[model samples]
Target: MSTKILICIDFSPLTPRIVKTGKELAKALNLGVHLVHAQPEKPSAPTAVVHQGADPSLGREMMKEIKELNNLKSDFEEEDIPCSYATPRGKTSDVIAAEAAKVEAPYIVLGSHGNGAMYHLVVGSVAEGVMKKLDTPVILVPAQQRLDREAGR
Candidate 1:
């Protein structure tokens, strides 16, 4: 029985390294990856109106996620890893924690910067926010290290 893993993806530039690390780890453990994104939230009263009509906003969020998911899948499809994507709307941290709990994933993964636009998660040490709250182990990619590795600094 392979373990299930969830990674919070935001499709930012830092995503490639995060995906690479995640794929490597998942392959090592024979685990499947659940790529998740917490969609940007608009106020309920206003957005709900846009959602109520035939123009339901469900597709709006999921559509972009689906494309990004395919990109992630293709990125490692040659490696024979099983990967999928999902999006559930809610507060950022709450959504990630809830999704991880729902899947009972043995590990939860996220990039240095999650949905929080305030600051870098590890740089500002906000990665602890998820790691501390999540029962499952959380893997945070130190993307800043990439610059150092590239520049040979």
Candidate 2:
């Protein structure tokens, strides 16, 4: 497999910066881009019973994510970038790391929301987990920095 830059998406508004970083890296390295969006397993109500072909809500959520990924792919294509996207179902960090390995990506670019330590402890840090779990080099762009750059500050 050829080397590519993996862009991890978490449905955040900071997505553009992550994609921008991935595109720049790909352009500089003359490599392709693979966009990976991992939706975490959602907790169901205690009364909810999950069975095969039974979750209408889950289906709708999946459809929404698929549409978003397609839109992202289109954005990259418009930039004349070689881009492929996937929205895989699993733990965010695991899915992202797996995608990086699957595509043999030498570099992974993603954004950090810069939430506080308590927030991270409660919600967990996907970027941190990805960096520790993956062997590939990862670049994490901070959301505040991206915003400042965009604002010309």
Candidate 3:
């Protein structure tokens, strides 16, 4: 089986940078890419009323994320890198780590905006949470640092 890298993406302005970084690493490491988006769980949201045996709201949300995943996967494909995508719903870190483990990923890549470090002290950061949960190597590219690196490249 081919080894893969799990890339956790949020639909942030830093997404392109994250994808570029992941692609570069995957190329260097000779591993395929597995892109995963962890949709934050909304505990307060009520279940959508069943209409014709379908939850319209849930379907809309899934469609949105799947579209984003396809777009991201296309980027990897353009680089000639084998890639797959998934959008899992739940606690961001848990979902990401679980997906990584399921795919037997050897590495995980993600972007972090340390601007929220203070807030994370109260609520916890997805990056930090993932670090705590998984034994796999994680590469966290801080958003600001990524901007600098991209500019220099």
Candidate 4:
């Protein structure tokens, strides 16, 4: 059976850096990739007599992650690597970890922002929270972020 790999994405420009790393590893190990973006539930705006409808473009723009995922898929295909993508809604950590376990992913790849000591101490790390709850081997792509260093390298 091929190894299953889970990659969490937020459509951040930083996502490709992380996805590329995971794709390389999957190619080396002949694993399948599940690229996902988990959208958190937004609290409903409080009832207001003067309130108007929620902005539609605001939500579609938020789904930039979906576009980024498709772009990554294209990149992976150009490399001749096979991958599948999905978009889910819910808490980021729960959605990622749950899907990973569901697919029996042997590996999970995450990219950090290098927000070292102080930042983690304050806002808390989303990646840290997800890793702590998953049983699969997890990889962190250090925030080297060298994508702009060169393209087609």
For TM-score, the strongest prediction is 3
Superposed by TM-score, candidate 4 places the C-alpha of residue 108 at a distance from the truth, in angstroms, of 0.6
Query: How does each model score on lDDT?
Result: 0.71, 0.81, 0.81, 0.73
Please rank every candidate by TM-score, starting with the best. 3, 2, 4, 1
Structure candidate 3, residue pairs in collision = none
* Candidate 3 lDDT over residue span 1-153, tens digit each: 457899888878887878888999999988899999876675312443433444566667667878888887887888888999887779888998888888889889998876555797788887778889998989887787656876896
Higher-TM-score candidate of 2 and 3: 3
How much is 128 displaced in model 2, in angstroms? 1.9
Please provide, for model 1 over 8-77, each residue's C-alpha lDDT reduced to its tens digit, 9 standing for 90 to 100: 7877777777787788788988888877787656553346666664345556656766787888877656
**Clash totals in order:** 0, 0, 0, 0
* Better structure of 1 and 2 per lDDT: 2
Minimal lDDT window, size 10, model 4: 42-51
Worst 10 residues of 3 by lDDT: 43-52
What's the true lDDT of residue 146 in model 3? 56
Can you list the residue pairs that collide in candidate 2?
none
RMSD in angstroms, all models? 4.9, 4.2, 4.2, 5.2
Error of 2 at 113 (Å): 0.6
| Model 2 stretches astray by more than 4 angstroms | 42-57, 121-124, 145-153
- Quote the lDDT for 35 in model 4: 84
Query: Each model's TM-score, in the order given?
Result: 0.70, 0.78, 0.80, 0.76
